[model samples]
Target chain A: NTSELASHELASHELASHDRTTFNPTTEHLTFAARVAWRNAARCVGRGYWPALAVRDLRHISEPQQVFRELQRHLRQAWNGGRIRSTISVFGPGVRILNDQLIRYAGYPDGLGDPQNRRLTAELTALGWSPPVQRSDFDVLPVAIETGGRTQLFEWQADDVQEVAIVHPEVGDLGLRWHALPVISNMELRFAGLTYACAPFNGWYMETEIGARNLADQGRYDRLPELAQRLGLDTARERSLWRDRALVELNRAVLHSFDAAGVRLDDHHSLTRQFVAFEERERAAGRRVNGQWDWLIPPLSPATTPVWARSYREDRELTPGFFHSRRSAF
Target chain B: NTSELASHELASHELASHDRTTFNPTTEHLTFAARVAWRNAARCVGRGYWPALAVRDLRHISEPQQVFRELQRHLRQAWNGGRIRSTISVFGPGVRILNDQLIRYAGYPDGLGDPQNRRLTAELTALGWSPPVQRSDFDVLPVAIETGGRTQLFEWQADDVQEVAIVHPEVGDLGLRWHALPVISNMELRFAGLTYACAPFNGWYMETEIGARNLADQGRYDRLPELAQRLGLDTARERSLWRDRALVELNRAVLHSFDAAGVRLDDHHSLTRQFVAFEERERAAGRRVNGQWDWLIPPLSPATTPVWARSYREDRELTPGFFHSRRSAF
Candidate 1:
């Protein structure tokens, strides 16, 4: 989390030339957010601020002058050619306005908590885009785009919120596709029941996928003695099975994240008809004629996504700081 | 520094804190100034932007449009709402703009850097109200504010610039002082020589000062051990002066730092004068009784500060898909 991210790490650091500039997620990013959260907690504790009353009387100040005076000090510093470490709210009593006002003052629209602020994040952690339809520690059901065969998957993890994208060698138009609901704090995640798993071909595989890592990157194929035993029977078949296994594992991960998000893609009538037509075409036209799709596009989650709420206002509030801290393991 | 001040470590830090809060100066307050300086650096590096060259490229797109069109997007999740972290820029060939619109857009500032910014930095830094200003390595000055004989003194130093002040502690009235022309840059620091010197108690004395700790919830006191011993012993009268040589050195250090910060007294009037009347008043005033000060204040530096410019920039311009790695230190 940074200026817009509400990330504490981004706020209170002195990145000198002699100092290192690398991100340690939990230590740096999370710790900073924790600091800000603590600051917020201090304000809450000092003024008896809590979940129920946080929205109303957000201000613990007596009159508007108390807040405005603080704002004036920060503004004066900024105008006096002073540098503001506002990212971490270090200006102290100086920052006493709504997030929108801060952004408006700084030449941007509402950031962080706004439903439409995408510029404040790195990946698709925003609930509106590839929002997580459902999730369990092990499985997730998500509505993602089917650009060819590859897709990006979003997840809400303890350490970071991020999207895991699987880019097939020949698929360049791939991206995650999703259907978003307004907001939901508590929702059940659906599993794909995917026990299917895949393993990638190792260097010793006698036969490997054409688009797979070549000998240049994998080194000589002869180096893996253990895997060479596959040649005795059918090395090509073994390699194929391994690759499929790898895909299966990746698919399961995607599902796990989707299930965690708890918002699934809705039924698209035209898409349903197109799916049938596309299946017929694939069968009649043959999977690969002239550099067409090399693999089958998995069926989109059943048009019947699990029943879930479209929005919830009082239950969960999505903030850039917390979301950025415990982001997905992309 | 253990983030704690020893009862006899140093007292200049407190003076610096006072200066920082009041924006008046005399002696350089090391610890307080250092904290302010570092914070200033953060402000400089992380300063919020002003609406410079403004360009409304065609129409702004929302996260939904981005998902539908496969365009780049930025957004926050339903967690941490205030984090800011997205940057999406498009270049020439990739963008389509109308000729007339392009002309209009040209009026907006294209970049963040502005000449006014640098000049203002130069001024704040000189006043010891900003970062640890240095040029090359030689111009780095250690700032500290000292107090003695009930008078406050501000000290600005380096291999180049030198300035000192003596003033009443309460009303902040200025008195006897000496100054040197200011020159900035690391190269100038090698020549740091200007010093604060005076007569009477100026030779040596122990002093204690207290301020906030790292936790920001506690207070700490630091004492100048060396200053205490020097004033305690009349070494010239003692036959064992040689055996106490170590004490001499420590006392000398204490005296040096102590003298540089001048004095802190409640009255603006002098205790020493040329005639018997002055001597009588001095004896009458003696040393007004006092106790320890336990509160929070920031330090200040003189109006002359050194300059620092980085040697590397282009090497670390994070590009698309390229953000600096956050290290554990961050």
Candidate 2:
């Protein structure tokens, strides 16, 4: 909650200088900061496309309703009919949202209903947002916006959200779809010693992020076994490496579907090549590229990538970049 | 080289007490030291079977020819017709062998011939050891035993080595074979401040030590692409995860072949379970188990093992343990 600001604290601060009120950055500065933030993202492999980042400056608005409307616009513009563009929308400082992302799958009381949306679904339901139908796995969660000492919910527009249907011969529809834009909403942006608490950013997905980790990790979608079974790989023994085989197919389907839909996503090999180029450019500029080796390496075929062989400096200084805020238990 | 000792320094010590002459350990002490050495092997996952170690004390002999004969005996006893057992042969101190292992594949000048053993083959060939016929992939390397300040080569007997045939339907017999026991020939065994520099040790294989790294690593056999092609995996695309699928199957073949041949080997799952039990036993005995997290976790299906989740103390302490001697460049 924004707490005392809207309740009584604003009265005492009303006589303060206008510098505090004009602390929010202009559109040009916001755009530059967003681009630099992308460049400084140590774990991102797609930083070669940093110059293409689009920034939406919504820092002038303080209302939760208006913030949500801008978020809808950001999603629609970034989605771009599957040709996803890296984008960010900066809501004004002092407003906070507890959720990490603007969209997430919800969990239900029964078995994992919408494997991705469960927690966010509960959070939205607790905030008195009603679903039009029984919750599904692909449900897009409403944004939890806190401003002026109060928290409110804003439902996403159906027209603004675009999902690519995963295509596979044996797997059928499976109803698997990821919201086009992954708007990281809860991270704070620190630039020139000023903190923007509600800056949401987006980038085009790397296929491995969706296929290898999200879909294959046991605690997440856990789709490997199902995919393996559908593909007729022997699942009775671990030696069969059914999981590994299925993981490849799952990743293949993701890349194929995204490419077929014309979404701007990268495969691991191309990303590794781009990262190598990024390293060379950083070296040419007399800057040592700092990165986390584990994060920089792709999940699948890790040994094949050059990033796996090299060491990286763990420089986690927070300035002109994004930093994770204190997470709220959902 | 023994240097001063062979050049008349022994004459001065010859008049000294027999205590200096008989510095070699007794058979019982050798057995105890061998067990402790296996327990201290940081990279080994089969240490739970340390109690069953069979030690061959050949410390009484100092001749290179005699040492080679004993090495043959060690191989046969350790091989034991595919029901392999952990074993070690303690060669007398003051003798240094240049080769790392008693057996290795011969690498030819042509493309990727016997990827694991080429260097040892060259070393032996330089010392006037001739191949009986055209050099094969699974060439049993001759022991280069150094004694009396001189190094000599000793060829292994045909009856001493045993190999399990890998049975994979698609790959057929690619002529891949490994010596029944991995006789680590150059490590020093330090017990109660006593250093035995030429104490060779052997242990049963952990399938991944063969299949995952030795065969699958790019610098080694690198059989994944061949296996993938044979298995009809789509190698044209990285997203297909063909390499990962082939790796799993290769690991499976290793486990299957070892089990079929009645060789005393363990799969990663069983090894992990045994390691967990070993940890518990160590805890119960008031000893904290020292292990390397990276070495303990198997390469194939690493996350599925408990060893991957836990941390280990990096213990480099060297008492009652085996240590690698300075390696001679081949």
Taking all chains together, each candidate's TM-score versus the true structure is 0.15, 0.79
Candidate that scores best on DockQ? 2
Judged by DockQ cut-offs, the docking class of candidate 1 is incorrect
Error of 2 at A100 (Å): 2.4
In model 2, state the lDDT of residue B5: 25
Per-residue accuracy of model 2 over B280-321 as CA lDDT, tens digit each: 876876667778765677766555455755777757874568
lDDT tens per residue, model 1, B1-330: 233234112334444345333433222222232222221221122111111111111123322223213111111110012222211112111121111100000010222122212333343345454333232111222222112222121223222222234232222322222221111111100001111110000000111111011001111111112222433533343221211222222222322332445422110001111112322332464512111111100110000001010111222221111121231011
lDDT by residue for model 1 (A231-296), tens: 222234321222222222223323333334442221122223343443345346343111111111
Give the per-residue lDDT digits (tens) of candidate 2, residues A1-330.
244224223322432323654554556656766777777888888888877898878778767878878888888888887778888888775688866787766666664644555676777788887765865656666778887777798777778777778776456664577655677887888766567888888887888778777667776777788888888988897656576667767877887788777887788877887888988887876667767665787766565556655777766884567888665444
Tell me the TM-score of candidate 2's A chain: 0.88
Please identify model 1 stretches exceeding 4 Å from their true place: A1-330, B2-27, B30-34, B40-330
Error of 2 at A236 (Å): 3.3
